[model samples]
Target: MQLQILEVILWPKAAGLPPRRVPFEPGKVNVISGASKRGKSSVIPIVDYCLGSRLCAIPAGTIREACAWFGIRVQTSEGEKIFARREPGKQQSTDEMMLLEDSVLDVPTDTPKKNTTRQAVKHLLDRLAGLSNLGFDPEEPRSGFQGRPSFRDTLAFCFQPQNIVANPDVLYFRADTNEHREKVRTIFPYVLGATTAERLAKKWELENLLRELRRKERERAAHDTVSATWLANLQVWVTEARELGLLRGDALEATEETLIVALEKVLAAGEEGNGFSAQGTGASADEYAALQTEESKIVLDLSVARHRLNQITAVRGTVGYYKGALDSQAARLGVSRWLRTLSNDGARCPICDSAMTSSSGELEQLCDALATIENETHTVSMAPPVLDRDLVDVKSKLSLLEDQLKAVRIRKRAIESRSKAIREGEQTSARVARFLGRVEQALELFSARSAPGGLNEELEKLNDSIEDLRKSLSEQQYALKLDAATARVSKDITRIAAKLDVERKDAPARLDIKELTVGVRDDAGREDFLWHLGSGANWLSYHVAAILALHVFFLRQLHSPVPALIIFDQPSQVYFPQRLTRPTAQSEEDDIGDEDVASIRRFFEAMGKLAAHFKGKLQIIVLDHAGPDVWDQLEAVSLAEEWRGNDYLVPKDWLDILE
Candidate 1:
């Protein structure tokens, strides 16, 4: 990827006043130099951040404030050209800040509040430029390679500031200290020759071994979990059976006897009869049958009797009642005549007082005359004639009906006698039938209780056998779980070994961390890289160098189209202490100072050579605060480009104001 940063402007974020801008050309190695507090290091990380490196420690406000101060704009490209610019306040710049191609701006930028220019550019590259392929995705931080970008991957474009004597792992500068001899050997493949590849393979082997062990543990855990469930269920069944006495060894006969006793108790409570005989007595059944037969006879007899009696009673009663009523009527009519005579006299009529009047004049005479006429008319009315002829005829018919009813009563008595005889004869059958029925019913009740419906004991035995088989299966499964875990660990170890290039001779059962080590070469005897190399800086450098060398060689073999630049921050921090050792007066000086210079010179020479080899295809940038002579030596290479210098400056107005 080719990047061109036009200019960066910084506002007064720290002690500095006002704002300033720095500019750089494309594909060039540029150095920014300044004293400690002048924002010299700011340029390195800002550019690094814009390029999608996650190592930057600078806060986002610093970039925003700086942009506001300098009125900055950036021009960049992915598949399409993009220009982005930002200014202070709520409204953000709509125009392209940087132009990848002269004709196209990268469309409209996301609103500033929603997305910052830095984030937008990162996303644009991830999609258009395949930045994700290179293990740097500013678009998404969580996704990508497992570890941070390594030393060899980023050596060319980034470096520490000048005059700082960091270790050679800084990528831009090399340390000559004797303590770093092994590291220098690893990074400079020429120093260790073909053996470096073997060293890398050794380190890979141990890592793979550890990875395999962990994988095995996980697999085992999963298998155990699955198998344990079945085992747990079996245990529960066994526990329940034991609690319910199913596990007791009593014979079926004994079990039946116990069940029979319980059944008898239940039957005694539910049944109506006393002992067997009480229960057996079908006498009630005979009695019910006899009663039913008797009732039928009685109903027939009653029907006949009732029909005859009803006819007779109707004739006799109707005749007598009507005759008496007519007689009474005649008597009432005679009494009524007597009453009329009394009414004719003027002392209030016996039946009605209104007929008597107290008037003394002609009105009283007229009222008395009207009363006498009314009484005479009432007395002269004839009584209704008695219907004696019809009554006499009905009395004759009633007498005939009464004689018929007497004959029916005699017939009913004969039927009742026959019914009673039949009832007495049937009682014996009922008693015998009831005894047999009770015995049959008792057998049915016992059968229902003893039998588990259609589920036979044979089937139950089969179920028990199946349960045993299932328990065995569960045990097998548990064993398989542990075996599978072992197998998984083995597979993982194999895979990681392939990746890490480590190996173990024995088919080990458990993990032995002490067996885990790092080294070069797949040779069987090799164990730890620490033992093979040295301690401190030398040891650390060797591993870092191996890592970088592996990457370079792998890329070359794959024929990948590598970027023109590589960037690395200070890596030697991990090994700086190792570079220090006990100092004898002269031995210390020679080791600490002179030896450091020689090592540094050698490191630069190696960098020059590597750069030359790839110079035909790419550009290289190295950043550092190393001695001036180092750059001078790098410049002597035939393929080297012109060096650019950088420094922080407060504008004249701010300087004057501060002063």
Candidate 2:
């Protein structure tokens, strides 16, 4: 993900004038040193806005008033593309933008129309940078824009403005604000490759699967609880069924879960299975008499139905058997009809030349028998139509009779169950009827829960999926990787810290990822954070070292999405702002001695060395008052433009036109 500004373009508010295209050289520390208020500081905000910052923070004096548009032409790995936007009016920002992508781009003589939007371009950049679209917070990613990393988050590494270049507390760009601060920390691991895109995706999947697994487990557990309750509560139903001959077995002998299974099996079997051996016998006097009378009537009807069904079945079988016999005889006798034709052959058989009269008597008798069988076969086949109708009617009546018998038997069992309760000195009937209704409902529910492809099996499947995803995305595994990666980064911080020679140089320095800043060790090996460290030079050194080291690490990785670019605005500001803190301070720190100049030069000198080390792979842009005398001799540094004397960011001619 190589990104560097080829040019910072400014379209003039005055029409028919060419835009100001300030060229920047790659592979060197490009310098934009100038006097204060020369828009040297404005370069950062221009670049940030063109890169799709939410707010247009370009300074609002001459530069903002003079320019019609703010744009930058950048060289990405995908080749050159120009991003230009109209200057904001009353709004904080504008979605209006001009985007061009190709092997070449033409900077318009006039400011172009609004060809795209800020958010649309940001999404395109996110893809261009190879960023992960997934969020780390698996619980609620949709709640806001905070869950995932954006290409914008990588800008923290790319800029160190005046307020930040030597600041003790805030090291990264926009870290002064809480939103950008917290977001950069969360995305630190991802930006450094400690958390891979695949791992992020898997982590989200695992958490979601675990949620589903827990839901299913709860449901399965509830089924378990319900099944347990069924065993105790269902004993009465089992007794009721056994008494009616709808189920067989001692209800007390069955296991809990198996009782639910038994309920399903017996209900599926209905009254057709062998459950009659356990039917009960007994009742109250009046109710017992009525039960007996009803049982007798049902029994009589069942007997009548059974006799009729048997008669229909017997007749059907007789008709079918008679038809079969007649057909068999008809087949045999038909051969005799053909033989009679042979007897009629004009002079006996062709091969056997015996007299026709000799075979005539036998042929005549055979033909007669054939005629008799054919007639009988037709009559028997005709008997089926009427017999089939009668059979169907009888079977239907039998089914109704059987249902009536089962109901009567169930009522009889109910009476007998009451009789037992009566003998136990209790009264029953209406209560038993209500209990039967409840039992019916429970059995249906139990059947569903204990079914084959039920919640338990689904929960088992979800558990398996969750375990598989956790193999790659476990938190413990990620913690170890993050610790190791931070240690690698800490080594870079310490080496660069030594290179800069900040205060307490003997102590080892480490980047505290939790603190989002660097810390130096004391004699007792207790850490001294940036804010706790004494000198402004010390803070400046640590900040520069940590940022440069992060970029080096980013470049070393095969696919670090952070661009190989760092912008430092006035590294000498710490040396100058110190003077400004005084009541007797001047705008120009004229008392600046050789020592102060040397220390300020050291920061640029270190950046210059890394620029040469990385060569074309790294680029640094410094906006400063540190002029040619400081870095002119440094081979790795080059001045892109010096906005001193009469030169400025917005040309004097543009301001003159406004006047």
Candidate 3:
């Protein structure tokens, strides 16, 4: 499925440039080369752009910016020719863009000779190269700057400098990229299996895990805020209770011992002032009076101390009771009641346990005691005016904590919901994983066998059968409609990959490449070349090898009607000319090495094999800055035969050169 360019005609009114004619000689390489910017690369876009590749690398300018106003008359098979041309800013008129002739009109319509150039071109691609209808638009003719099919599909793999290597966003198969692994797996399903799909499934699982962890964190934060708020209010209550003599601080201290010792002295003074039961002389009136006053003071101090101890006990009891109640509340609400409490009742029935029971009578008693303590505490805290300030402070703290708790609960719910979604996602992911694995395995098998099953065609056929059966049975089938259009295109590609494997082996490899990845070791226990030699030879081998592999893949797997043309904008980049010791007087020297020439010869030999495979239907356009030697090799192969077609040199004056 090769396309040979016949003649390119430029319309006078189309732009202003004279029509350029380039011929296609059979088996010959049309070497269009000249000084830099002499429209060497421009020739490619000119042909491609006319054949429905809209963004043909030609800059968007006037006629001068384009490769030049050109009309391309391309011959497919037989005498049929497709005439296509484009102006700078007008739509390509369809009247001048259709098939012109047919050779075997009498034959069956399916025969290649009977078809138009357009149809023939499509047939050659589909039958020989296994290509199908390229993404060419039959309607809505292309206006200048109109979007067309992707350049890769339409342009037939042009290797311009911009696409020399690969980039992340560019979805092309590169040897070093992971995508290549998928390609190889698709091509050699027996070896790689469906690993690429499995990798994607793993990514989905990781996403689920992250979602679950976030849920638990939010729950924990809410619990902390609730606990903090409860503790802060308790501290204020304790302080107020202490001030009202309802509670005491530091019960175990030496200050209490001093007070006790002073009380004992006061008792002794009272005994002395009483004069030992009116018998022995004791004290004067002034001493007796002082002793009585001291006695009264000690009694008052003892009473106050007792009151403080009782109040302290009450406050302690109240706090313990409230804490117990909170624990019960939290337990009912599904909070962690065991937190910070070693004696958390372990699954004990509160009704059975006397100590645990929240009896109404006990609750009332505790409430009354709390109220009394609250009243005393509030009085001590207040300045004899409003108790509302202290109540407001407590209320404010509670409100803030409540708000914090509410927010935390909201966050917790959100997290929990997300976690649930993640769990569901995980389940879905698992199902997806299983599905993908099956698909991958199926793809691998499909690739290995090149059978229709991998294409999921059988599934599609089954669905179609089901629909037909349902239509006949009830005249209305809802379930069948859903599954009827679920054909997997990727699977079809895998099936095709498998089918093409038969031709891949023993397909002539590029002979010029230095590195031949072949098999079997030599007598020296080292691998021997199928045909190896030196460095220059190896370079050519690599180049030819690459081209050969691509050629095989393109012919066997690509299913499109576009012309199979390998346009190398700068092939010399790979096949460098030999260095000369003596400076040649000629501006351009012809000194390609013998090894280089031999490698090139190998490439040609490989080409011969491809031509045989393709039946002389391959078009290779090499645009380089070469001397006569390159043409000499091309001529030796009888590639320069007159019937070959045409060639047009883009004179220096035609285009502006970019330095």
Candidate 4:
């Protein structure tokens, strides 16, 4: 992608004064060099603000007080786009902005309300830069929350403010925060064509898939542990129940339903032969028998209700499992259909190397299969509601049976108390029968607690899915080839540094891909890095060389997404003794000394040379306090009229336009 700043316009707060405009040329060094406080440094911030910066970084003073809006015109691959942002009020930023599709030379005279938002403008710019589809979740495991590259993120490489241009620790503009620094490090290779957007996305996908795989492994381990414990307990319970004569010998081979039925029979037999004469309790033996029979009927009803409740629960679980399986099948079928469509449109089949034939019969078959899966999923989904209704009815019936059983138990306890006073002979048989009944109920509960059906099959299917994902991840790992790219970037930075004649034994000699820092060789033949280098001159030199070299690398690549522009603010700061407070034109005879003059000239000369070497493929903009004499002799350098005496980004006439 290519971007050239054609102009920067500052709209006045009132209609009487004209908007201030600064024009720039493409593929050349455009220097806005002159005195202090002439808004020379504000250009970079204005460009950044117009580009979708969340906060307006323009210093609060005369410029902010006078200008109603800030705008910029840039020529891109998609033609010229003009972006205008309202002057931030008291807030840190504003979303309101004006966007035009044409090259706007002047700000509109009418009071133009915001027609778009900052995000909308960024989307258009992202499209021009071929980054519309280039985004990934920053929270992915390996990604470390280094957010995806935005147009502004790339601009951090292109623009260097005075505060950052001379800082020894920082290299890129506004990269003071750790998060911003990580974003620069993570996105540098990608912008240089060492990695692609697709590869980056796939890398994140693989990381997520691996995380999910580990989760499934943990889930399977937990299930196995629980299942083993359940099986062991069931076996012990069954053995004890059989020894107690609560279950018959054939009971060990019984299913859940048969076990429940056996428990019911044992419970019924426990109720028989409770010896009590009605005469002693002032009731007849017939009354006692009738009461026992009623009690037996209620117990049977309670047992049946509990069995029905268990069956309803089991059915609900089965239906839920089937529904989930059908839903997964439907999702896979949809993906397959999408892949087939892509294949028909000239994409190669992923499974086979040959061109995919668009067979109508095959397509029809897939469609039919998809339809069947969808129908099955819908059918299974509906079963949950019916099962829920059945569960509610079963619970209601269980509650009613429980109430009846509670009443019968109360009456039997009272009768037994009275019978105990009359007779105690039948107590032994009754006690044995009750113990057998209790044992049978325990066995039935154990059977119900066994492992769920089809667990192993489900685990096998998940394992197959993980294997397929791993295979796909392996195929897409080609995007991580950063070694060769690092070498190329390192070489380019070294070559550019040499061209600029940055003289320090510890100057940058290589670019580190992982740390995103420049490496240098020391006098001891040991390698050092840029952050350890001393002096503001060396810092400025290394910063400029690294940025220019990266742009050069981008120009050489056929698919690089970096814009071909680099903006520098006061790179000649080291040459100046103190901050220049007033506008003073410098000549060759100025007392600035020869070394300072030479260094300034060399900086501009190197920039001009690189711009010429690229042959209209790169644009360089410099903002400084140097006069025309510093760069008048340089070739292909366009010097804007000095911002010293009367010239400035915001005109003097418009200074009083603030309402």
User: Per-residue alpha-carbon lDDT of model 2 for 1-659, expressed as tens digits?
Assistant: 67888899999989777899898987779998778778888889999998899999887778888998999888876678999988997688898998999887777777778889999889878766777666767677763435867889899999998889888889899989988888888889887777876676666666656766776677667767887666667665777767755577654556766666665554444423222122223224566688688878878887987888788778768978888887788787777766677777745755577767687888899888877776566445434434433554555566566556656766666556444433432213445434444564566455545567555566677778777877766789888888887888888888877767487667788877777888788899898789998888898888888998898888777567788889999887867644322323244545444577677777778889988987588889988887776667886889899886678998989989999
What is the C-alpha lDDT profile of model 3 across 132-165, one tens digit per residue? Answer: 1111121222422221222234232333332331
Displacement of the residue 618 alpha carbon in candidate 3, Å: 2.0
RMSD, every candidate, angstroms: 49.7, 31.7, 37.0, 16.2
lDDT of each: 0.36, 0.75, 0.37, 0.69
TM-score of 4: 0.63
| lDDT sort, best first | 2, 4, 3, 1
Candidate 4, 170: how far from true, in Å? 1.4
What TM-scores do the predictions have? 0.31, 0.70, 0.34, 0.63
Name the weakest run of 10 consecutive residues (lDDT summed) in model 3: 105-114
Residue 544 in model 4: shift from native, Å?
1.0
Give lDDT tens digits, candidate 4, residues 1-659: 67888888888886777667788998999998777778888998899999899889998989988888999888875457778899987989999999877544445665457999999988766655655242445244346445556676788679889988877777787778887787877777667665555455445444544554565467567656765665454455455546656456564543445544555554444445455545444663555677789889988988888898888778878887887787777777776676667666877777676666755457668767987887566445434433433554565577567557756765665456435523542334444545554554445334332435333544565467657756764633534556666677777777767755476633448877566667888677787666787777778878888888778777877435577889999888887634332334366555554676777777788889889988787999999887666677797688865776777788877765442
Q: What lDDT score goes with residue 368 in model 3?
A: 55
Residue 268 in model 4: lDDT: 49
In candidate 3, stretches whose alpha carbon ends up further than 4 angstroms from where it belongs are 12-18, 59-68, 89-544, 550-562, 575-609, 612-615, 631-648, 651-659
What TM-score should be assigned to candidate 1? 0.31
Better of 3 and 4 by TM-score: 4
| Root mean square deviation (Cα) for candidate 3 | 37.0
